[model samples]
Target: MSIATSVPHPAVETARRFARSSRTHDGLRCPNAAFDAWFARQRLVNRFEVTPVPFSRLRGWRFRSDTGDLVHDSGGFFRIEGLHVTGDLGEWSQPVINQREIGILGILVKEFDGVPHLLMQAKMEPGNINTVQLSPTVQATRSNHTGVHGGRAVPYLEYFTDGSRSRTIVDVPQSEQGSWFLRKRNRNMLVEVVEDVPDHPDFRWLTLGQVNRLLRRDNVVNMDARSVLSCIPCLPDEPAGGAYGRALHEALRPGSWSLRSDAEVLHWISDLKSRRELTQQRIPLSDAAPWRRGPAAITHPTGRYFRVLAAEIAAANREVPGWTQPLLEPAGRGVVAFLTRRINGVLHILLNARSEAGCMDVLELAPTVQYQPCNHPGRPPRFSRAAEDPARLVYDTLQSEEGGRFMYAESHYRIAEVDDACPLDVPEDFTWVTPRQVMDLLRHGYYLNMQARSLFAALLALA
Candidate 1:
């Protein structure tokens, strides 16, 4: 709770006019300047640059054995000016490397059959500055666990179509925004940064979920890699006092941050696990947290369709081929919903949270439902596309035109899993702005669909 107690890194704060309206919390809104700049929305688009060399447009169809899933080009050298570099979402940037050095370098990534791979790596060498490497999209499989920590896991129930087998979900996928997440030719994704960080030049590689680690490492003063590069301070910003200075500052801040040591970090992690168990609430760093930035609900906008999730679908009928059946509903008004249902099949099945161009195939885990705010979204939604345009918590309980049940026309914000200097709480900057404040911000404004009086009068519940 007192982790961020000492602002180890300096923050650049300016007095900006506080908008009276808006419900999304500030901590949930943008990366904290005080916690070091982080771009939550970087992974939605291509992180690095590459020239397309379409081997063949829509090249026929289904792939064969040992072949890659994606057939795109891989030869271009653009600046690593975003998540393309350090994988920090939008603000993650990169230094331009030479064309020759930037060619794709195929590497054997751990993958199984029937999944796709997005292998990309950007490393800096003497002459190979900003050098990028990409690989043919290979099939992938989701990891066994999902969490930012390497400790014990809490168990949960998983029901399949054939019947229900109580399986303990020990391995929580430690997937951060920029963490290496891959989809199989069909099912879930695997995030591999936490498990692979130590190999990163000894803490040189920082995962999105490890923002807290980065701070702790810096404060430790010797356990981690400091972004040190001579003549390049902040990372070359522009025609003014740019990244050169800023980068230096970032790399060097912890030189005096905390008086902690490697022993202290070890002690913290060791004890932290016990503390987590004592509290039944899911810890801030578990797989359930989704603080990293990206589109809220990425569903295909083509039709009013319904589906049985990919992973669960596969489980239902792996003997046949790929994700196949079950109690699937139609997509109403295009309000795409991603459920985590258990699909019974041969071998294992994985359902992920990522969607490719609106088409989603994740397992829908219902029965245990946790509601989250739908924030800063990007997609032509079928039902609630404009839900988060304003800050208010818009909730309208109405009967569906074609239905027999009550539907909640609720406004949403992409709720992110946050863990940092402190435990997840309503940070001071935003706590003052309550539900009323949020209502005011969206009241009759541009992009805002409803006003306070009308919206409040129509709602049946408030979060």
Candidate 2:
């Protein structure tokens, strides 16, 4: 880690104080009143209202047919198409058309005090309760990120494209898969900058440790930041910083889980696949039992889970915030967790064999838990219980940042560890794997979900 000349940062002391209180080993709690007060002063107010627009009237975009399929474009940037697929829960005749969306999410880091600090923004999206959240340095769509619409410049975009003065930690530019809802994919990156960079009021430089600390609090780090952080790659030979950093490095290092032969892991996967697998059912939106078409969007009959709504955004912060688009809004918070345990002195993460309607493949490895609490209040949760209970060794829990692109999408993320006593006779749908094994799976695509990848990236940053 390296940096340019240091400037006096007023938030550093506050960041350190909060970091000390929110240690991973000690578990997490809300920050003190002073920090809360300071945090409250930072806000992003929406100056424009989002009004629903007809699909035919959408400017700079159009719907076209391709090989009997429908695709959409905004004149420039990536395109969206509907994919017909059925999940394990669906019958052969029922297929859901999942919207395929693609975008970019990147982060810029600089070293401070021999430790890496991330450059984050106090950005706002239409669906946030807090109005603003700590987001990635650069989170934009292909259109905005590429300046196709001729909007304001995205901050720190040059470091990613110019190929100058940076260390690329996570360069996974990939797509996402989770068919129950919105289908999205992004180009994710995490880089360390070594040159001088100007600071802005909306921008703050916080150590990776500090960022993880803030993550414990509600609505702090945004989804884009989490997703990008999860992509960070941890090389076995990389030098970790001070004692604290080394401890983080060691936590992610191979426990007994890594010593297992590849054949054993494959066998485990095989056994799990045969015994337990996720199943889903897809039907026409019109025939969906729980959903209804409202005047402006498709929503749950009870107004729960998620709803699709259109908005007309107007903002000086965006090149064309004054545009209309459709977004998804959730009824309440969602959860994304990674369950871990030490097997033979090696750390093993618990991954779920999840099936999404939009996934190219039928199943992929997901975090231990990724669910909308309001959508399934009666069902017994997955590893969510362990992730929420600090006594269960699940200290990595934190509320998700708002998905600015989404109407109102947010989730909490956690990484919890279970002891042998927790139960070796777990459900067949789950498997314990080493961090390295998971990273290898990442390269193959669709094996790991974006939420899971974000947590892994955060773990790598700790080193």
Candidate 3:
């Protein structure tokens, strides 16, 4: 839990050089001009003429042929689906376009002179306005990693699977594409190289401090990188009177923020579970009626939760950003937050058992709040009624979501401290658990969704 005092990394200058020479666009820098041009050339055209079809007849999505019978790959990897999710908080009248893939998102770490440095990539995505941003060392779909697409294999894949030499810092399945994706998860991992490894031009080694500075900006770090970074544990050393220190103060004294105790919070959760209910049912896309059909996309009659649109993208920096593809767009910005309280000197987070139509399991533990602005019901009555000072925050930052693929991807991540003396009321759908306990549950797969995992990474960075 402690990082020893150390000097600046030797590669700090190298990282700076990479950042400076990169092409700047809307504050996001793309280090590779070819990649930028490649992305710019992409031609995104919405095909509003195509007729809507059944989920089983989803075009372009591949199905498995088991014993000569075409079947959905339920256990293979990820699948595409049409989801209609409605709850007391919000209702989506339209069928949501979703991707339920479990990809791999990993970070490579190495220590020099007792200092830890991370290897990041300046990768390009089709939906990114800036073209390229700092990404994880290894970000690839199951097909890419498995060479199904006949592309170069993901680098450092062995670091995660090879156990003899690599030391695992964090390895867990974190959710992605939360707003539109039906429980799309990724295997997020951070591993320390035990021996010397080759480096790539697209990747740069950066200190945690350097990464933190970049994270404060908009669309500078991709979602895959942010999710991986959020899992990092607290450092051994941190500057005094910083945001992390302030957040700790707020968490320790609910009185400072006019917040209730652990007991009161539990009671509120109980009330929420008792009143609100989420009901979901699977139906064929063709039968999902009242949806207006367009040549390019399928949309709800009201356009509330999301819409499926086709675009032809031609990016200057993308290897092949010039193709037409279908994408999902949400109605508003999302929020992912954690409510933390110190239990006998250890911080324990309160998590909710949330479920999505595409999730493999019935329910998985999620953050205190993971919903879009339109979907969120606002602060609970008890929390809204409580008095609070703004100064007692441990971590509060508005971070952008995935930019390249998701339309209007932005979210706020915050951690607030409350008094522990309030009533210990509990809710059937919610429980309080420590970070360590959550980490342990992560090994079970599908326990912690992507947003919760990202907050965990942010907590580590801020701490």
Candidate 4:
């Protein structure tokens, strides 16, 4: 008999490195305390001002006389159009952002002292509440990177776009908020480099543990960064500290026992997709009923869901020093929670097969509860109360949505460990799955919604 040598795949080695980095909170390049001070200094030094302006006052944007769609003169960025969706629930029409172009949300990784550190940027978006937050290494739309905006070149873009410069660790396209953008997707990439990288004033190298720790804070890590970080394939090989940590670690292990097998979960998703019926049609913005356009904004009659408003922004740190664009402002803050429970000694999270007007597919796996308190008034969704219980709450933090498109939009993201009272048999639309299953599903696009992905990243932080 001939003996064969076992060799680990490159991706597996990369994941191991990431796992090691995740265990080290204080990076050699930038310690957590030093990062906090640098972030504060960046906020103070940069000049950022956002002023509300009327539609007529927009510099390069105007409403089409025929379709009444608010579009840019260059027709490169995004346009506010009307989307009519018809399904079993009912039929409705609303203004949705039509951004057909895909963007790049890439993070660069480099090894220092045998541990990996990610390159992060202190980016400022007009809609962020704090005016600045930690963003990805290169968060640029095709238009911005292609010079459609006629601004300065985006820094550190060559590492991701030009493949020869760095080795690809994880490169997958992921969906954004299904309800807000129309068929939107961004290329979420994590690239590792071997050569020395020049330092920029706004950029810093931090460990994966530091990034996860920042996730616990409110509006510190931006939406794009979280989405990309969730794609990193790293699960602790050994049991983590504490009871909850141990359970979470076990749940994330690939071959760990799960309530539902991989085949069963895929079948469930496919069955749901085949049975559900959704039809959407594009119409002019003026034809959207119950929504009126005013001098300053386009608002609904009762101002329930969201409204479209224009803003003039000036940021000294951005590629473009000044610009004018439209922003979607939600009525109120939203709640995105995941209900977790130890099933058969393993942790499992409850996910909902939620459908939205702008989803490319009819349904995507969403959080246990994704709703705006203002929109639902007295009628709260199921499992929300359990998730809000102070005693059962495991992790709770306020996170902002994509600041470039949404104005002051934030959600209270929570993870609660429910008691056995919450039974395993849930509604037809909801199902329980382990973290490993969720991570496996993430390898393919559109399986989990943006809110769920963000919560998954938060869950990993717990381990």
lDDT for model 1 comes to 0.18
Mark the regions of model 1 whose C-alpha exceeds 4 Å error after superposition.
Answer: 1-139, 142-249, 252-266, 278-371, 374-463
Candidate 2 on 112-201: residue-level lDDT in tens?
Answer: 544455677777666565557778888877667767676788877878767666766556555463643444567677767778998766
What's the number of clashes in each of the models? 64, 21, 59, 0
TM-score order, best first, reads: 4, 2, 3, 1
Determine the backbone clash count of candidate 2: 21
Which scores greater on lDDT, model 2 or model 3? Answer: 2
- In model 4, state the lDDT of residue 406: 94
Candidates in order, TM-scores: namely 0.20, 0.72, 0.67, 0.97
Q: Considering lDDT, where higher is better, how would the candidates rank from best to worst? A: 4, 2, 3, 1
**What value does the lDDT take at residue 401 in candidate 3?**
64
Q: In model 3, where do residues sit more than 4 Å from their true spots? A: 1-80, 84-101, 129-131, 146-168, 177-179, 233-283, 316-321, 342-346, 376-393, 403-405, 419-426
Worst 10 residues of 2 by lDDT: 1-10
lDDT of 4 by residue, 49-164 (tens): 99989988898899999999999999888999998889965799899999989889999999999999999999999999898999999999999999999999999999999999
lDDT of each: 0.18, 0.57, 0.55, 0.90
- In candidate 2, which residue ranges exceed 4 Å CA deviation? 1-41, 44-83, 92-102, 112-114, 164-167, 180-183, 234-251, 254-259, 266-292, 300-304, 381-390, 396-398, 439-445, 457-463
Question: Residue 172 CA error for candidate 2 (Å)?
Answer: 1.1
